[model samples]
Target: MSTFHLKIIAYDKIFYDDEAASVVLPAIDGEVQILTNHEECVVALKTGEVRIGTPKGEMIPAVCGSGFAEVTSDNQVEILVDTIERPEEIDIRRAKEAKERAEERLLQHKSRMEYYRNTTSLARAMARLKEANKYRH
Candidate 1:
């Protein structure tokens, strides 16, 4: 089977670096599937889950914040995101607290700017919690 090298990096760390048979990323517009030597392109990423299929047939899943992905014609895929976390690494309690805080802020803040920030935070926290729980088994 054909495979490609995939590197996923965040601001503070490298989340993954390995050979993958395929990858499904949450693009800003929608979900995108990438395979070996697919194409050369760049796309914005939304806050969601990224699923990677390894050569050994293992599936690795990660939660990613907003970012971008670059795909090369030579089968190199680089994903740079604001934040990335594995399911096991995430603290469900912390994510829940963050979500509550954001919700509180959303209710108390009347300014549009504050509302937007709180809304985004709430969305991100919810995404993290949901993704983390999905892999708890």
Candidate 2:
């Protein structure tokens, strides 16, 4: 199977740097999949799940915060995001609290920017909780 260099860099650390067969992540329009030798372009990402298919046939799942991805001409994909966490790394209680806080913020009147921020926070928290639940044994 063909593979490409995939590097995922979160704000706190480098999450992944290795060869991958494919990657599916949340783009602004929706989910987008990238394979080896895909057309070079930069894509804006939203808060959602990211599934990486490795060369060894493992599907690695993660939740990611807002950011962008760059597909280079040399068969390399680089993702820079505000945050990324594997399902096992997620703190369910903390995510629930964040979701509640964001929901409370939504109920109050606020500036447009504040509203948007709260919504984004809500989305991120929801995504984290969903991913964590899906992987729970």
Candidate 3:
């Protein structure tokens, strides 16, 4: 099976670096799937889920904040994001608290900036919670 190197880096540290069979990224427009030898490209990523399929058939799921992705002709993919967290790394209690805070901010609805900020936070928290639940054993 063909595979390519995938490196995921967040603000604090490197999330992953390994060979993968396929990668599905959450782009601003939609989800984009990349395979080995995919054409070189750059894309802006949205805050959502990223699924990486390993050569051994393991699917690694992660929640990524808005960022960018670059694919090289040499079959190396680099993902740069503000934050990335695997399902197991997510703290459910923290996520719930964040969700509640965002909800409270939304209820206020004072300004557009505040509204969007809160909404984005809510979405991110929800995405993390969903991913964590999905992979929970």
Which candidate wins on TM-score?
2
Q: What is the per-residue lDDT of model 2 for residues 85-111, given as tens digits with 9 covering 90 to 100?
A: 999999999999999999999999799
lDDT order of candidates, top first: 2, 3, 1
Q: Residue 137 of model 2: what lDDT?
A: 97
Candidate 3 per-residue C-alpha lDDT over 1-137 given as tens digits, one digit per residue, 9 for 90 to 100 = 89999999999999999999998999989999999999999999988999999999999999999999999999999999999999999999999999999999899969999899899899899999999999998
User: lDDT, candidate 3, residue 1?
Assistant: 89
| Model 1 lDDT per residue over 1-137, tens place | 89999999999999899899999999978899999998899989988999999999899998999999999988899999999998899999999999999999998968999898888899889999999999998
Q: What is the lDDT of residue 68 in candidate 2?
A: 99
Per-residue error (Å), model 1, residue 27: 1.0
Alpha-carbon lDDT of model 2: 0.98
What number of backbone clashes does candidate 3 have, counting pairs of residues 3 or more apart or in separate chains?
A: 0
Candidate 2 residue 5 Cα shift, in angstroms, is: 0.2
Report how far residue 110 has shifted in candidate 1, in Å.
3.7
Task: Show model 1 residue runs off by greater than 4 Å.
Answer: none
The lowest-lDDT stretch of 10 consecutive residues in candidate 2 is: 105-114
Point out where model 3 deviates above 4 Å.
none
TM-score of 3: 0.93
Q: State every prediction's TM-score relative to the real structure.
A: 0.94, 0.98, 0.93
| Candidate 1 clashes between residue pairs 3 or more apart in a chain or in different chains | none
lDDT at 108, model 2: 97
